[model samples]
Target: MGAGLPADDRARAIIDLVRGQGYQTIEALAAQFGKTTQTIRRDVNLLCDRGLLRRKHGGVELPPEDENLAYPARQVLNIEAKRRIAELVARNVPDNATLFFGIGTTPEQCALALSDHPGLRVMTNNLNVAMALTRNPSCEITIAGGRLRNLDRDVVAAEARDFFSRFSVDIGIYGVGAVAEDGTLLDFGLDEVEMRRSLAQHCRQRFLVLDHSKFGRDATVRGGHITEATAVFTDRPVPPAIAGQLKEAGIRLVVWSDDATHTASSNGRG
Candidate 1:
């Protein structure tokens, strides 16, 4: 029973269980740990506040669907793939266009890749992305200010959303929590979902950048779908079934690799 378990141990157990199952109700979780509903609720709230999990109506779920790890931890995972995907995304942008960079590792990598490109007007809620651009003197960067979230290191309040509403951009680069079988873009937080939707409205072209791991996963909140993107960029070749759906929807799939012929052949499979 959780009564005899240390607080840290109990919290770790809860996290492990939630990660394995995706989501669990408060009552169910409490019963499993032999703790009162109130105690479990406190634990859930604490975890949510720490950006570990998201609190839903009935229970708690893992933090933003695509990323099961905390933000700091996620930046270290898939480093090479994210770097390659970012390079591809950076190459697609025009030199002097206004860019909207969304929150997440992929976007941050893209921002880093863009450091060499001067004369870029960048607007983002991600501190990391903004910082990356600011390191280049020739790049102009604007950060949306609001309540900063520790998990993704981005602003997610109404003020930030309102600030983004004031400007349109040539390109908007976004990352996903997960991609559904039918190409639906998903995330966990309602605020993130709303922010992404708002950003889509202000961009002439939208790009979804993610690794292959993001596919076949589901999130608590649905952002925009693949149809909303001008192109989908990734480090891996997407499965044929998923590629066919994107092709049917008129979304271009761009796989990044040093060997063009190899990439084409690799991407041509189911």
Candidate 2:
């Protein structure tokens, strides 16, 4: 086989193929792309090193759904898409509303977008979020006391759950590690899951924010169901099956594209 494009372009296409179909082989990619076996191996190794994929017995495959990228790695992925979803969610947050925030990159993005929202009280398990929204002095911030996980900069466990119990927030915003194939919302830590559930109970409306990358991704702890959230904001269209499930559950689905929010309901899964 002969090289058809630059190494980076071929590498990207290799990842896309694996992401869509589960896995791909160095031999197969070499044949399809007209590249040598050694060249394909190099591409797979680079992606694996970056935590984008993993080496299976004979082929490279997407990482396990529960296998999270490094916190820093996660923050840089889908950056513009996250900003778009953040804008969509933040636009609906009024100035005087009290809110709850959990941990994860997408929620962090949402907090940043709410910097100018005034007259709000925010109770959060994420210290970074507290600091981000503090840019608006008009908004009071309260952070839960707990042992902080330095990797993700989130406070979790008994104290965090107890602290969230003290307030009835107008909105509870959360990010999932992944949305399961069955439409179940999932995260990684058990304590974080409990804390999120507690926060949800203390809020009047719940908003789940995540990008489309989480679709079909895996995670271990169960946070809640799609029906549990009042609405979900994302950067890509929901697939037909998931859209139907959400619609049947009567949860509003909003997808952002070209700086516009296109809404879909249970009846309009097209």
Candidate 3:
């Protein structure tokens, strides 16, 4: 609700808000931003034209439930939050740990954070993660065999899912396309979801890395839940109900904000 922000910043904020809230009316948006309805309408029109949002009768929602944002846009959106989450996840990793890094920008950022770590073995279907680890001379990277996905720069074919099942790693780091308010994890397609499931099943510890915008967001395919993770890392605290579930499941919640990380296990352990 920072009305002083420039138009582009406001538009991005609007997208995140609508994504978290499902839909927002023009008047509601204007009131939230302390702007006029006419100004909000103009912004909504531009967002609709760009296919980033869908204009309903008197409100805006996400573009399409079946598709995700363009990869480049997703890469830059919530960039700072993703970096902080990634760094904290990396700090928890041991120097010689073996890892399974899954698809998405957040995983790639985690790989980047581990660049200076020694004696690491990484198995990944994400090309970006593999390339990021290549910068570390002491890290060993194994990539899955499949035709690369040009859009996401990762492979999520059936064989890739099978490839993940063959490894029993110390940790699995992954990101989801969206998260339902009830704590269900959603992805764009079955292959991606299956691949993530396989990674979870094979790893000793599962790290779910995501930014706050993913909460209440929509996606086509749903496979896992937040409780499946050993720890959930994000830039903001999750919804109260979901946090309660995490506590019940004894999963660790790691929040990164204001340049500091706060970690607590659901069982009241630090």
Candidate 4:
């Protein structure tokens, strides 16, 4: 429905994702909205000039202390950083692995990065993930059946838990709404969090991917702690206290900065 959705609705969706995720890149926006890069750029320019968004290196982000942007807007945010995280996630998740892509723009980016890998099975509650992974001919995709959340195109309900109960996944990847001050892994909805916990419990490994914007942001649902993730991939240095907590909890932090990779090049946390 997103691909065939009207221009105005598409733009609004972009704004929702951007606001929620904090960033969106021009190219990613174009792909997600099924528009040309030129068209998306025009929209971004208007939004920026109106003081709604600020330009990033290759994307647009919520300006000032904004809490959330459109989903399409977030698809474009921190494009390079998300791509780097996606690449590493794809590389680490072996071919033929069974994966679960939970809600968030970054998980959709991970689906895009996995377009080439063959012999994979993916289950997701996010419509964006299903659309992105449709390019991979060899990958079998399963979508959870549940009530649709119009703004984000995610499926969540009692049936969603049943959907996860049917599969044993090899890798589970998710995007966070924010990292709460008390070291809680936060998100927006209680249903979404419960669905995520269910999906995560079925996987052998779970990784959390988010850009720097999530830190210090406010979100209502306490999903869990960073320790729930086997590894956390971010685009910048984490707050020292958070990093220490991650290290202490035995969660690996992988930062994808422009200058270098704060990776688990060895088994150690960064």
> How close is every model to the real structure, measured as TM-score?
0.72, 0.78, 0.78, 0.74
lDDT of each: 0.82, 0.82, 0.88, 0.81
- Measured by lDDT, the strongest candidate is 3
lDDT of each residue in 1-270, candidate 1, tens digit only: 555678778988888899898789999988999998899999888788767778988799876644456786568556789998888877778788789989888999999998988799988988989988888788888899889887668997877777668898899998888888877888878888888888888888888889987898767788777777788889988877778877777777889777743333223112
In the range 37-102, model 4's lDDT, one tens digit per residue, is: 998898888777655578999999876543455676577666777888887787677889899999
Model 1 / residue 161 / CA error / Å: 1.7
Give the residue spans of candidate 4 off by over 4 A: 1-67, 257-270
Error of 4 at 236 (Å): 1.4
Q: What lDDT tens digits, residue by residue, belong to model 2 across residues 111-200?
A: 999998879889998987887887888989989898898978988867667888888888999988888778888888788788878878
Looking at model 4, report the run of 10 residues with the lowest lDDT sum.
261-270
Top of the candidates by TM-score: 3
TM-score between candidate 3 and the true structure: 0.78
- Give the residue spans of candidate 1 off by over 4 A: 1-67, 258-270
Per-residue lDDT, model 1, residue 225, is 77
Tell me the lDDT of model 2 at 262: 54
What are the per-residue Cα lDDT tens digits for candidate 3 across 1-270?
A: 667879988998998899888889999999999899999999999887766788898999986756787776677777888999888898899999999999998998999999999999999999999999999999999999987889789999876669888889999999999999899999988998999998899999999999998998889898999998999999888899989988988888988757364543356222
Off by over 4 Å in 2: 1-62, 259-270
Point out where model 3 deviates above 4 Å.
Answer: 1-62, 259-270
RMSD of each: 7.9, 4.3, 4.6, 9.4
lDDT of 4: 0.81
